[model samples]
Target: MSETGRLAVRKTYKLFVGGAFPRSESGRSYVVSSSKGDFLANAARASRKDARDAVVAARKAFPGWSGATPYNRGQILYRVAEMMEGRRAQFVAEVVDADGVSARKAGELVDAAVDRLVWYAGWSDKIGAIQGAANPVAGPYFNLSTAEPTGVVAVVAPPFGPLLGLVSVVAPVIVTGNTCVVVASERAPLPSITLAEVLATSDLPGGVVNILTGHTGELAPWLAGHMDVNGIDLTGCDPDLARTCEQEAAENLKRVLRPAKTDWLADPGLDRMTTFLETKTVWHPVGI
Candidate 1:
């Protein structure tokens, strides 16, 4: 290894957005210690401004990334799956420490999360065809229905199923070509930040996935009511907060996905993908 390559460097972890790593706009950070009382790293306590910045980054990258062909997006999502495979051990250990699950269960959960990424990756190239179809109309115009991303999505992943839930929720939004501003599980933000690292190293474009670590109750309402946010996935929100988010979402008619009681560890079908998609219809002239 070259001298620069082999030289030891201090480790620094901070908020990731707009293709760069910058400290939180609030300039506030929180400590993350392991169960063994060993400090892991400092997690950024994102603020309203930080959230707004993430939204801006997401919005800026949306048009180009979303306009890309599904095949290209599929390739990027698949790259994330490959990256996850190489870090399986790290994720399993994080899950065990954060959620207090057994090693085997942790491994299983990480596997589920990685597999979910691959599953959603495959959907990127196929959902448009599956969810889109021709609309038969009596008029002299030809009509077709297609699906498109709802733009900047704000995601609240569940607390318990940190790894699986975050992957499950975020993958669907971006795989369909939507940029996202996500609040990681407050109790277990490590895995989410680590996942951001994976995305950074993978083929995903910047701002395609912006992750923040902080109090969900404080951040959720801000993201929910933010005018720039096009949709919200409340899979991680508590019942009371979820209702409030639903109410606030009506102002912009933002697409709101309420938390589900179903088991994500069991098997996740097409339901997650459908929630982040919009049906677009196109009409053309066809004469006999």
Candidate 2:
């Protein structure tokens, strides 16, 4: 076919919720452009209603996901890594176009993201063991504490280093059984939406990870104050926005993870996962 005769298929980036791709309820979309000022595609401009719907999906999927065995969750997460590996070239291209990075750097970022997911997958069954503890009591009672899922979590993915930053925040949240509503990078959302495609087909249960592409300023407040939402991660927000969201989260006593300047490529350790988990201590008579 002649170059002029060939038709290009343009993708309409939509929100991924409940394992399905849907347009914004408001029927709104915004133009996304390449770093070189060329038009890329139109991404769904998520609204407050979209945020509410994503929270509902996350809440509905919470029980099954949280109740699932840690080993099962780990396997599912590993499957995501496998799928991502298969789509490495696609993600690398998206990262390059979105961030204006060189192909080599983009490939490195994609590889790091895949590796990050695998790292979190290994932590699934071990986190509880590491975070939980047994205590010695003075009386004839047995006491032990264990970590538990904190229910639905809302994550604001970082604006820069889209793929690596996104994986860094999200892998830790869902690895421990907490379903999440993620706000993709506003300026560079293609990689995140593409990752959503990987999640949809990777044996991950629906609603376990909902990704929305839009302005964080429009959606963060609603998620912060959402009563059903158990936690919020502001790792992608600016200091002022993060502070505002933190205040809103206090309305329902939600666990708020404030934004911090960190190296996404550094070892994350247990802090990210532990921040969203709750501790439960049980005591019973030893002679029962």
Candidate 3:
């Protein structure tokens, strides 16, 4: 094929829901541009209906994912890291073009994202031991408290450092056995869409990590107020949007994780995972 006569084959990016890639229900799409204003590709523009569909998918998968053995969950998360590692070059290029960073910086970001997944994978089986407690009661009984998943979390991915920020918020949520609906960075969603491909092929069950790409402001309110959604992570929203979403979340007393500015490469600790967890205590009669 002559260079002058060659035609570029462009890819149409789609939403990742229920372990399947589908175009937005609204049948809408928007052009994604590189940092240099070069046309990259067209990404599905998710609407409120799409957000609702994602929530339904997440809720459907919650029981199975949350009920899985801790070791099994850890292995699935580890598989995510493995799949991500295999696609490092693709992610690095997307990061570079989206963020206008040097190849070295993009590579570093992608590496950190992969390592972050591995870190969360290691925490899957350990969180219960670390967060649960045994208590001594002043009666003929034994008492214990355990941490459990808060179902159907909705995450808004950070706009800056799309890849790293995305992995940071998502890895912790799913590692703890909570299914989630995530809105990828509106300006730089290519890397996240690509990551969805990674998840689909990993050992993760369907709908465990549903991803959407589009305007956060347009879809956030619907997710925040969705009666079935158990938690909302507003890490990607601005002050006003975050506040608005928090207020909506109050209707159902949903767990709300407010946005905070932090170095994405810093040690994240266990705060993110714990934020969406509920503690349950049980008492058993002694010497029955």
Model 2 stretches with alpha carbons more than 4 Å out: 1-5
lDDT of 3 by residue, 188-263 (tens): 9999899999999997899999999999999888899999999999999999999999999999999999999879
Residue 178 CA displacement from its true place in model 3, Å: 0.4
lDDT (10s digit) by residue, model 2, range 1-288:
458998767677899999999999999999898999898999999999999999999999999999999999999999999999999999999999999999999999899999999999999999999999998989998899999989999999999988999999999999999999999999989888899999999999999999999998988888998999999999998998898899999999998888988898889989899999999999999883
TM-score of 2: 0.97
Scanning candidate 3 in windows of ten residues, the lowest lDDT window is 1-10
What is the lDDT of every predicted structure here? 0.86, 0.93, 0.94
Q: Write the per-residue lDDT of candidate 1 for residues 119-218, one digit (tens) a residue.
A: 8888988998999998889988989999988889999888878789889889889999899999888877888877888999997888989988888888
What lDDT is obtained when candidate 1 is compared to the true structure? 0.86
lDDT of 2: 0.93
Give the Cα error of residue 10 in candidate 1, in Å: 7.8
Query: Candidate 3: deviation at residue 2, Å?
Result: 9.8
Clashes (candidate 1): 0
| Prediction 3 global C-alpha lDDT | 0.94
Error of 3 at 47 (Å): 0.8
In each prediction, how many residue pairs overlap at the backbone (N, C-alpha, C within less than 3 A)? Answer: 0, 0, 0
Considering lDDT, where higher is better, how would the candidates rank from best to worst? 3, 2, 1
